[model samples]
Target chain A: MVEFKEVEGYDSLKSELKSLEKSDKPVFVLFTGSKDSSGKSWCPDCVTADPVVHASVKEKLSEGVFITCQVGPRDFWKNQSNPFRTDSKLKITAVPTLIHWGQSNRLVEEQLFKRDMVDMLFED
Target chain B: MRATLMTAMIRTGAKQCCPYAACSSSRSVAYYSKSAIDTNSNYDLVVIGGGSGGLACSKEAADQGARVAVLDWVAPTPHGQSWGLGGTCVNVGCIPKKLMHQAALVGNHLADAAAYGWQLPKDHHVPHDWNTLKNAVQDTIKASNWVYRVQLNSKKVDYFNALGSFLDSNTIKVTDKKSEKTITAKYVVLSTGLRPTYPNIPGAELGLTSDDLFSLKKSPGRTLVVGGSYVGLECAGFLKGLGLPVDLMIRSIPLRGFDQQCANLITDHMSGEGMNILWRCSPLEVVEAGNDQKKVTWLSDDGKKESQVYDTVLWAIGRQPRLQPLNLQAANVQLNQKNGKVIVDDEERSSNPSVFAIGDIAQGRPELTPVAISTGQLLARRLFAKSSRLMNYDMIPTTVFTPLEYGCVGLSEEAALKKFGEDECEVYHAFYGPYEYTIPHRSSEQCYTKIIALRDDPKTVIGIHFVGPNAGEVTQGFAAAMTCNITIDQLQSTVAIHPTSAEEIIKLRITKRSGLDPRAVGCCG
Candidate 1:
């Protein structure tokens, strides 16, 4: 089983990113809705994409680092000026955004559900 | 001296270390450094209220590298109903209202669809299911609440589900059912927003406000809406559209701040849609009248007394700012005596230099969601990004979600005439039918559009008003044009898209001053 590291919120993501930058391994950052006390994401899309992305990350990208960055709840994601949406390094427009760090390719929203796309994202 | 101490403490990454922690003699220093060294005061910015403005401001501030925390709590309504995060817009105000309005619109479209040659079974009787709509709306709100929580967490903005009150200029005391804690920040924003106010009449508790009406489980059968404000009109309009018998009681005129002519047209459209409007009447009392019904007694302008029984009585009188609970005196934030709203400067800074107010809580600003969001974002940018741009309160476009929607931007006709003399201004208007309405043979009597502009050379457009289908969609582009200083000639010179209600704006030639019949003659090339 592929072990995926999870970090809560933007500050933790920033700290995790800083640590990841020091490593030579390929970085895969998946921006998702933060899980509630019920252990479920508010984003239905993220809920659907989470397991598929996790399984793919574990199988194909064994050597790569998988960082699941929980973007805060619904209202925060809906905000137009959110760092997840506006940040140059990670311009996340939708939930369940999978990005191969420093790469041009990214899968957003429903694309995260496709195992082929998840594999393609991991391959790069 | 205190500033230097704070700077040194922040620079040295000192936590839980205060020189004044043991010193009880110097009260000011102890108080200041106590907050500075405390874990709660670690935040660079603390925003109160998780409404549109507060949430936006908090996220933006956090994005700009400010350690931020947001505190939000929903006080139960008089009817003992409360909602989750995302404030009034998401929970009770804009989102649910718009959805219910859309549901009512779909109801009308179904009737229109039948008229459009769509055959239905003879037994097909489509009735409005209140529970289904109520559940759907609540579901959406719940989803939004979850999203807000996730977003706040993801952005690194600490979310405190507690009611916040000022303990000092830089420190706030947050209390929930579980416990109480003190949070301190370098800067604090007050965006607590507002709540609907009820009349002080006898047995008024029997009535419901917009806050409770949206989440009510049962159908609001045979409703009576009081007040002439947009809230009352919209609730009455949607209720009537849902095929319920609705009566609206207004003390005087309708739409107090909008153009009277447009307001009259809106009321006329509502009347045409079977809304019984009682003008110049005030509610005297509401009493329970057996079997889930309430008897509403009212007095007319001429002292005529009347009573009616209704399943629901919605009070849409007006909204009051949520400042009382914040204990403004504790923070020394000045409020406008007349309106009880926080007084703010151009930068939305309150009387206390470190405190700022935005959205509906700030006096003399429009109480719209977009306005609040924009102001919040701009305020954050100015604070953390070192940008000096201020929020522009002028020419903000707003749409009333009446059955025949009304949308307007810039100055109203009365406002324009009052500002600049009648001779300096000219008004162009037209009554046109939507193509879809023609197919259904729906009366287009209330469908109209008007543009108010200066009579001088180039004739700069001052106000744009439209009363028809999709008024919001039609007025939004015109609002953008008005921002560019668009003139009557510029508006007319632009080629229009054929067979659309919005295109009627570009073809407005009959000036209201000319006394020419503004009615459309025919569909001509």
Candidate 2:
């Protein structure tokens, strides 16, 4: 029998870039959902793109810092929202987005994908 | 530091790895790794849902020498995906529904048995022992299940009787709805098919869904069917044919977004079948009328509540994925929040990358059984590395099993009109009564073919919607054409077999209503 540690949940503040300041690790932040009025290309995981965003982060940077920001129906699950911001920083847009935040909680880089593009994204 | 990780990922995805475990993770890492790593359970492939896709996936894997297991929840024997192993299309959904409707259509022919100058035996009162007929249908399902079980046994595939859910990516939990067993595999193919949705409407539970109605006992004296789409029409129509007084209520317009013209014709024919149609009406509640009857209360367009006395209430609104108990999340598979469908890549991989899903669970564009079967086959071939490339999902066609029957390949007129514009779109329609019914002048013998082609680019037939006789069976070949991206000219140039509803496809011409070049559209000429 395997004894696994229960994954704990985070308290809600608001999911902003600044939330990464709390953790020492430089986290990979992913924002995902429907297309905005500005007409961004969309991938309809609808609201469920939250876990997907984190999964993609775990994909490329397995041990790298990882955090998630979601913009949709406000009744976000207990741990699914951000620790700093609630409403979106940018107007709501495409899904499964990977936003790389560097030290000091500043935005570093971000990207979206239609199919398998890990090679393209991470390749120097 | 980031640059190094990025370069590593790039090289990781592109560089060929050794045939050992780590490189095996790249080649078979997606779904197969889980299947491959599970040594406790001797089976490499164990499919839980015996619907069309499940059967195809398991049977093919077994053919490839993988120890396989297939489980289904269908009772009186699960014949659906078995195809004998063929799956639901042959056993329940398509085959039996079409056969039942065909039997009803023959009712019209029996009326004219004397016109052909044949000596009448007891005035052609066709014997329809409802109990006996129902049993006969169930018998076919049983025999098909037996055949499937026999085939799987011969092929050395374990056939379990249970509903299979995920214990983990590599482990499956099978509950016979009685006994439960947990088995693990290296890979899992989730193909548990869809079931009718029971939305939280008042008295919703009182009504029977299509599954219950199909295997029902005594026919209701009066049946109230709610839902405007094919399921509603089919259930009501079948009940009416079985001599049940049927009233069909549609809250919205009929057929929802089907070709407006075809929807209207279907409504007309449903009324002609002695089935009452309550347009712009919906069931609000259901109450009991003694033990054997039900009182269905419905509201009209004007918001007036009317009491309806029905012996049975069949709710045929829509179908949603039946994946909750399947425990996809345990396997790191994610389902679309807006719909119960799963998130899948073009190859049908879940976000986890260890599992693959198809059919209702795979959350692709189409949700028909045939679509599921196609995806299952494609996934098997791709995962096993048998195929050179992946499956194409464009232009998949499907049909409805209504009394008048409707089949559509590609886009509808409404979608076409929206995409291409009314001015740019054209429809070629042909009307005919099958020659077999024409001599006696059965005017309702109305069968029509509709070909939707872009006006400027008329050579490409974007959609083909056929209604009337043999719509389901005849549409298959045409659907195959559309799957291959067959143009209008290609469809027209094909030789047609005569005295058949399929011939109407080749007989498409400029509709009596509108524009075309001087040349007739049909190829036979």
Candidate 3:
């Protein structure tokens, strides 16, 4: 069985990850920029990568918990000391970063737009 | 007296020079002519230092199927601090220093956050925690040490955690804590690097060197950094950035051999950032004060005596090659009388054809890690893989990670003017503000860049210097361009990455010879 979780910010993502830490199934996480009231993300690359990543995750992940994370607003992200960038475990340099949680498998920035790389991240 | 001291230093393997040019004593020559011992050759190569140079040479030779053994040992500093196998750079020098610099940069960003429209609670200020920052830096260093160890093991290179002293040109005496062994190689390499030197003053042992600062158990309170070497300035810069009261004392000009104009700008920016710089000063003595403090007494150039108590005093006077224990005399290796480092030919070959020296221990070579690594690999390739490419010592890029980082390649402005006369050289310069600094209204008075070239048609770039954020990153591509013999016309013709500090180099037009101001113009200029 597969489960899906949507996380809003870094704090809630930490709590959500804590609950999934002991799950037997694998975990996949996709981090993107937060959307506005019009549902348009401030990051152009994330807006372009969202549907492609979500579709690839649904098609390739047969039995893992897929996590869709909204990192923060543009202002928060621009602050060089933001938590997402500073956290040693998740030193995310840019949004639209997809990770095969707990593994070194990751696709960052434009890598998320490549269908083969996205499928490989989910399948591998 | 100075000549006597120089002769004694040469005999003892210290790099201190004789004040006079009268250092050609017969006694020094007699010291290194020890008779050779008979031994059977056991390996193709034996490297005596496990630093960047030695490790790279050993690994490259091993990859070429040469039987190699690396002997490395870290002697404790005066303060009893010792580290693992990756040498001064990974343990005490670059890695830890850059990480700490980053920590200070983070503090600056946090201070600028409010101007970027980020809200903070009233009266909410977080003090920098030295312990946390130290732990993070140390962790990275530890991991690198382990990785280097694993890499050596996987490469099939014999690793000996012991001190190697030369018995002859081909034989080495290796000694560990509990065992002693003898090994011989067809060729020998000396890359022992250097150690920080303390001034020849009374009670000098009380001060800490860079080797001991990285692993200090507690925070360094109000600090006094002695000397104006790049090491001294960098230590003072980072300490001040971390919100500590730091005083930098210099006996002469800061960064003696670098571009003096750029060096002055660095000092000026640091002064504006609240670092107290005491110029034309030299320390005479250091004595312990009560309650974990030391008082430094000094005489200024203006004939005044001054004393101040500091919780930490760092001695970054200079460095000496770690050759004392190696017993190079037994191998008949020659040392330059002027500077006590090993005398090597253009090919890095020492006085003895079978022996070589690289990195800091080699005379007249740039004491940089990348230079060491590249030369080591090239030497290994020539010796083991039959490659003929020589390591080019020209136009090598380097960065000093200060509060306002400085990165430069090729000759300095002074060197360019000296090499090519003032009438034959041209200098293009600019002082510009970074786009990111606008929100915080940060001062960009010291964010500067310079390009030096010949005044002839299609002037060949002789040098590039930049002092701004991410100076190293900005100067790297330019360094590559220099290697290709890039010309000033090509630089001007290339389109630049918009709104970047780096693009300022490509867009440079105002020359120092021109009477026009070199300050920044508005956007789209």
Candidate 4:
């Protein structure tokens, strides 16, 4: 079974990742737009990819940590100097960007929407 | 300071007569001192050259539990260009060339998009910024270099960023910027590949070679590419495709060793695409003409001297093995005097039995990256893994990335006919167009494919040739089939997926012996 955690900001995401740094299990981090009052993300791609990422990760990861980072409202993310955008390690250029921590595997935008792409990412 | 501390610890540990069981750190120190005490530290295998072949060999040997060391260092070109670990193919050859070729193809597609009802701005020509493409290509190369290094480290293979020269048959003196050291090995493998050769002409240094072109910061404006080697043709093709005015000056023939027909067609296609082709012309000299341009002098076939002014001059005449630096005489390694490559036996063992050579540096071996890599791995296996398999150098498929690419395996039509005699060889060919070319109306005349086979029953295919879009992709499968000794009957039985450039290969039916037009008809037939 996979352990799922949701983080609201960049600092929380970093702390979550730091806690799992020593883990032998595979760690995957997903960055997406935060949900609003209606439970829909401001970023349309994140809204479309939300179910697919959770479903695929839950099914594929037998034992690992999958962190979903909901980077605050559009105004904060839209700023060029946002930590999510400026951080060297993260370098999140787009919403709904999935990264396999400590590895180079990454999927962004519509890539997360494809079942095969998600399957390959998780399977590998 | 760290070296002094380590030496002191070793002496203290020795004086105390501490057993390895006493401490883990001391145990590791004792193991390290055993090798350090012996100045001529030995390795199971030492591979010189860090290119595709050298790296592959070192990794394979290490995987087989042999202590392997690979020494790789790149000497900068005259233009002061140097690259990291991964050799020619990754840094300057295939990777960058293919990217630039694809970039040129994308440029062409942009122009063609309007024909497919694309709402592109009217009469707006898309300009290709050379630096943008160059930087992207360099970044990709750097990433590959890092990956290769990581792979070597993970495989437990020691990599030396140093130049290796032979002290003896099994001893090598490896030198780097900081220090020099001699390492002896049970076996030494020399895979130092070839470098671009410049013609012996006055002011030759004024021209750039393939080594310099990939990393060039500025756009190669109106250019004259001298020589008809695949390198010259490919550079000419891509430069012209990239919207540069490119002139190709051929001394005698284009693609001298490849199929003459395919070579002619490739040049013809480039010529049709607005590139100037100067046949039977040899360059005399290249001199600076001021304003960041050059005045190139050439002698024509008609005993006439001609001159042209161009912003860039590139020499793609040929490549020669870089053997002088290795000091073959010191190791008693013999070379083929005609060409500077090392003379090696079937097992790639040079005159010095303790030493072996592979890749382009070995005499009569195909100078291709894949060939070098395979040979390297095989040599390692034979040396360490108790494998007796010799690297097969037959039916190796290769692709020349001209605007109209040429990919083939086995004999050329001329070679097949000459070897099998006129009556024994049969050729089936076709001129076909890809469906995608329909709307864009790209010329289909040079888009061709051919099969050379025995004239007997079953007609076992001896050669496969393709000239079209995705030639490499189309020919790779056939290369495997050729390895299986697939015949015409087998090929004809296998159905092809329609609407692909590759399908044209399977649809080949018209024989040159039949004297009928080999032009393609509708897809249904």
Worst 10 residues of 3 chain A by lDDT: A115-124
Docking class of 3: incorrect
Q: Model 1, B203-235: lDDT tens per residue?
A: 999999999998898999999999899999999
User: What is the iRMSD in Å for candidate 1?
Assistant: 13.4
Tens digit of lDDT per residue, candidate 2, span B1-525? 323422333343322222234444553464443333333655656777777788878877766556678877653322122223445565646656665666566665677667777677864566565676666566566556555654565566677767778877778888875699888774578777666676566777777776665456665557888888677787677667766678888877777767877787788888876778898886778877787687887778788988877788877788777677787778878888987787877767666554667787677557677777777776666544345356677677777778777888888888987998877777787766666555666554346778888767545788898887668788888888877767777777888788677887777766534654423233334
Query: Which stretches in model 4 have alpha-carbon errors above 4 Å?
Result: A1-124, B1-41
Task: Name the candidate, 1 or 3, with the larger TM-score value.
Answer: 1
In candidate 2, which residue ranges exceed 4 Å CA deviation? A1-124, B1-41, B74-92, B121-127, B177-179, B444-446, B456-458, B493-499, B511-525
Model 1 chain B lDDT-worst window of ten: B13-22
The Cα RMSD of model 3 versus the native structure comes to: 13.8
Model 2: fnat (fraction of native contacts): 0.00
**C-alpha displacement of B17 in model 4, angstroms?**
43
| lDDT on C-alpha atoms for all candidate structures | 0.86, 0.63, 0.86, 0.85
TM-score of 1: 0.78
Candidate 4 retains true contacts at a fraction of 0.00
User: Tens digits of per-residue lDDT for model 4 on B241-315?
Assistant: 898999999988999889999889999999889889999998898888999899999999898999999999999
Better of 1 and 3 by DockQ: 1
- Report the poorest 10 consecutive residues by lDDT, candidate 4 chain B: B13-22
lDDT (Cα, 0-100) at B8 in candidate 2:
38
Runs with alpha carbons beyond 4 Å of true place in candidate 3:
A1-124, B1-39
lDDT of each residue in A30-112, candidate 4, tens digit only: 99999899987999999899889888876777988888899999999999999999998888999989987876567788878
